[model samples]
Target: ALTTMAKWEGGRAVDARAAETGETPLMAAASAGQLDCCLSLLTAGADPLAVNVDGVGILALVASKVSQGKRSKVRAVVRLALLNAAPQLRVLLLHHEDCGRHISFKPHQESPERISAILAFIAKGATIGLFSAEELLVSTEFDQASKEHLIRCHSEEYISVITQLGEQVANTPVAFTPYYQGFKGLPQAKQKKAEFSDTFFSPGTMAAALRAAGGVVHAVESVLKGHSRTAFVCVRPPGHHAGVDGATAGAPSSGFSIVNNAMIGALHALEGNHGRLCKRVAVVDFDVHHGNGTEEIARAWHAKHRKAGARAASGADESDLFFASIHLADDGAASSIEFYPGTGTRDDLHHNIVNVCVPPMWIGAGAGGRGSVSA
Candidate 1:
């Protein structure tokens, strides 16, 4: 393979497409599970982004083989192409065990389970030479978000309350219950019983929430500073449900959120103390339920910018932030079957806010899933 690759080093042999199928050497190697040949071809300059006659990408071809129980082979080829072939597209995947450690309702430990499963899959790929050790940048130790960072999106009072509650939960042992009645008697909980009703804290809740917020901040910094072109942050205590005052819109509780991580990361990028790292930022939320907290934050941020623009009389009407939330729409006239935190609607559309509501029982087929909606 080396001798042949050497001869085709400067030639188009590696990427030469089949006359009928339009498949390149790299695509063939990936389809046949030829890991060694795939690596050699990649090193010799095979374009992993090449598409076949059916317009199927090389990564898609590799992914299609996973159902055959060839996940290791698929990961090796995909990671090699992503990390090695495309130097300009350097990608980082960041996660930590602490992000998954949080109190949850009985028989519903989705946060920890999801994190463990994802990490296990990535670990399996790493063990099978999916990519070189140097290509994978996993940060096990990262700084926890400070109070200042948390205050960027959340109110100071809210932050103080959550921090105090987290500390109290850390020191005292609270009984686990499906309804979270165990925490109702806490002093802080009594202060805002409704807000903390749905959310529960554990000994590791503070650590996980801090890490989740901090990990996102770090990921943003790494991308903006050119250390990586993109990053995937996998942390729990999901932040979209959290708003400026813990819970926003009509949410009955914090919705299992401690800190608004996404908002914090965006604010840090746009207005961090170091300096303004970005002139414009966009947040796209894709979830079954609406990201009411993110929308609320974006709305407030835009309002602040509008006020600043008006006061300065600079006529700078353009916004520096854009937020889009695609979520399941509430069932009209079906009050009993309404979704959680149901708030997003078509009427919510603004210059910088876009709410794409997917109706219940809607099935998108083929390229129909790529349908677009005006902001």
Candidate 2:
């Protein structure tokens, strides 16, 4: 079967479906209890995740054959599909020595200690068989993102200034204006000096930031290349707050973020070297504070693609990149204090942007917050 399939133009032939039923060759083989033929089709690049006209997947079709008591035959086909479908989960972790050990700002709520606690919890879960070791791929070593990758979501000058400041923090406190002026020039030095006050930086910050951004990039590429169906990237100096120019949503600082890693990864997947691997991508951010930087970047990406006459993957007028931010909103009461960054309102929506703002005092499903998000 494998030899015959090779002569039929490979994947195109193996995945060909019936016009009336929308069943691929793999589905037909599984339905007929031809285990050998199913294996051959999978090896020839048949997609096991393909569905029929009723939207029933190949695995369900194979499992249905078990009702005929062909139990062993059904099991064989299911195992083969699972192995070929890349169903394993990939978890990307930053190296302990590389992740910044000095970014311990109390307000930011992120530190080396927090990462250690999270890792311990995940390790405990894995030990108890919450997930099998065979199904979990944990990678600690990954390439640091280059200047080009960082510049995709940030300005070259901002990148340079931040890099210099991170290095200078070793010899001088971030409070030193003269040292910062030496790198950024006198005119912009004062403004840049004040921005760093909100976010702490150390000698290890540059390395940690690069690695964090790189981990996200690697995760995106791995999923697109079919190495894994899903991936979770665990890195530090949280993104989603840093915009193209570093500060976001008129915030006084970069919102404790040095670079926008998520936007960089999204753009990388959308605009690969050979061609785009993904025509449409969505970033759904559910955080206490609004992801102003992510929203800004998504808006810009849509505008750029729209200007170039590029339509969405669904052939809609909306941009290829869709961003939805669900975050806490400030109440209109006189005594109500505004939240951090204070953006992402219902009125701030765009064609591809969804800002679902939940009031600070909102509680339970009875509240309209859930409905706003659902809509």
Candidate 3:
């Protein structure tokens, strides 16, 4: 009944009283053996905890039909009945993709309130130790491996539109000065700090969404060891469009389709190990999109090295080690985007992207070695 109720879209149910007193149509129909109606009502938001005419629950109503019972017997019977009711409960817990709605208000707000509403719930979960700081940080994984973002895979056109669209759907326009604002729907202090930080893309800027205090960003060391932190560690401006470089589906050819999270994290880790590290590492991508931009970064890294090698031949004592990235991809031509000469990207490439490509299965698809570098 609940499933049927939730699935109903063309027109509402005859007794769709879910909006009134919170008593959904599913709850009303599940009282009897209207199995079809029962399935339908359970599909919608129906309360099984509802009291019957004699103050008995629907569970108790159904439980009465079971075999004979005593104290433990009655208790076990109730548990069995409840456990068997999961099909009806699951519909209420999840909402699937909206193939029907032309537009959804899913990404509607950038204000603190919408964020806070979840935080309030998460805070309760945090107090009980059910959620961690990583869960609360609200940013991408900050992997050193992903620093060398290629511009080609993630085309400039797609990136610009996505960022613009993201802002249109998620940000509020404010000055980058003193970091303060008095918008009615937003907080003054946070808006101020965010406004100011948006101007700077360094270490702790909120624009980059870097939560350096204590976060999953440190998971770069072993994100692949576990399932939860497998996503790339995010560090600011949160590179949404970064890749190895290629053309998407029907879109024109572009750069890498990934942000060099792997490259950035790996380089940072490598530099920490020794000034002179391995000159080669391979990055294999398995994402649905191509990584043209990541390839662009590798190309740039190669160019810089050729120059550095030229300088070294002249006895400048420089070895700007260069590398390569291998992208395994399906074309997403429809989603291809090009990027502007954003300094953030240049800064990333100037510092990282030196490696090779391993066999496929890097991102959680198949079994392959987690990338490594020894001094």
Candidate 4:
């Protein structure tokens, strides 16, 4: 498979390091303690001496394995390799943090059990040294996303309204109110709580939401600018449900989501392109709930840029973006809120936006019965 991929990449991709971290496969294999595979790669002309931006080498990796415990068989292989290695190969083994990020806003999930689980997972992983401390960044340092970034994917009106509402709720305790008017199945008394309010807000809610959005923007920006190889933004009050302007399907916010983090990040990436705004990008969403808001934002951007001015004479903006979504289906009538914002139907496809709804049988209790995922 490696040979096939190398052939497909014309003999350069195998040795090509990650664009952000400059890590080669040998580094990964050694870090994971695949001794025999590392030896095989060394024999196959893989650069065992190659270092990442951090200057850690394969010998240093062997030291890490020794710290864990080394077997006689591997010791023999290492001895043979060292005997034949260049003078540069005998060097210090320094283990640097990998260019991957794990970010979260624990306060936003709203469920105490979920928060506990997240904390427990982090604590347990750290206790076992699953990853180094430097790599496990707590995202409190990032500022709230600026209005310029927010307005890229949302309306000024919506932003102003949401911000004022957040401030109001932050100052006083209030019950959750429906964001949209004429929301079905609500008593007149309950509907009078407030207008355009979806979920209960508190002093911490806006701060948490801003951090969540800012974290995603930072993650995407870092990866694109070659500062990090991968980043997992574990935020809550999830954004996929909210649409381009935060008012979609008659809901002020979709689900509990007020801001579309994915869309915000996507727009930032698009705007930061080095070219004449012609670089292509893809947004692949696999949330169990469909990312309708993200879809709306992507489609709008694609349509606006599909035909460009003289600046993009290369026509790079045309067919330059794609959005794919996979999620559970809406089984009821199209008009029903049980469909929950009612967007991700099978028929909703374009040259750019692709939506696939998993069949109902493949969804819950009957999931293992028969239907396939493609269904």
Which rank order by TM-score, best down to worst?
A: 2, 1, 4, 3
Cα lDDT of model 2 by residue, 240-341, tens digit: 988876766456566667788888888777765445767688888889888888877777666655676866443433456788888886533322465678
Highest TM-score scorer: 2
Candidate 4, run of 10 with poorest lDDT: 93-102
In angstroms, give how far residue 332 of model 3 lies from its true place.
9.7
Model 4 pairs whose backbones collide:
60-93, 179-196, 179-197, 243-293
Model 2 weakest lDDT span, ten residues long: 366-375
Residue range 1-375, candidate 1, lDDT tens digits: 563773474756878999999998778777766666777776776765677999886655664545667676676656566566555344577888787677564445445887778878888886896746545667665678888888768877778766776777744323322223323343544344432345676788888999999999999998787676568788887889888876774565667777899989998888776776777888999998888888888877677767666522222233767888888766343334566786776434455887877766542332112114445
Candidate 3's TM-score reads 0.28
In candidate 3, what are the lDDT values of residues 1-375, reduced to their tens digit?
446436668335533544534444444444332345544444453444454445554443442333454434543444344335532211111111111111212332222243335546756876886633233223333322222222222345533433343344323332322221232223654443442232221111222221321122244333322222233332222222243322222222222111334444433333322232333344444333334344454555455556666542222222333333333331122123222212111122343442222223423344222223422
1 versus 4: better lDDT goes to: 1
The TM-score, computed over Cα atoms with residue i paired to residue i, of candidate 2 is 0.73
2 or 4, which is superior by lDDT? 2
- Model 2 steric clash pairs: none
Q: Higher-lDDT candidate among 3 and 4? A: 4
* Per-model TM-score on C-alpha atoms: 0.66, 0.73, 0.28, 0.61
User: Candidate 4 residues 163-188, lDDT tens each?
Assistant: 77667653553433453323334566
Q: Model 4 misses residue 204 by how many Å?
A: 3.2
| Candidate order, lDDT descending | 1, 2, 4, 3
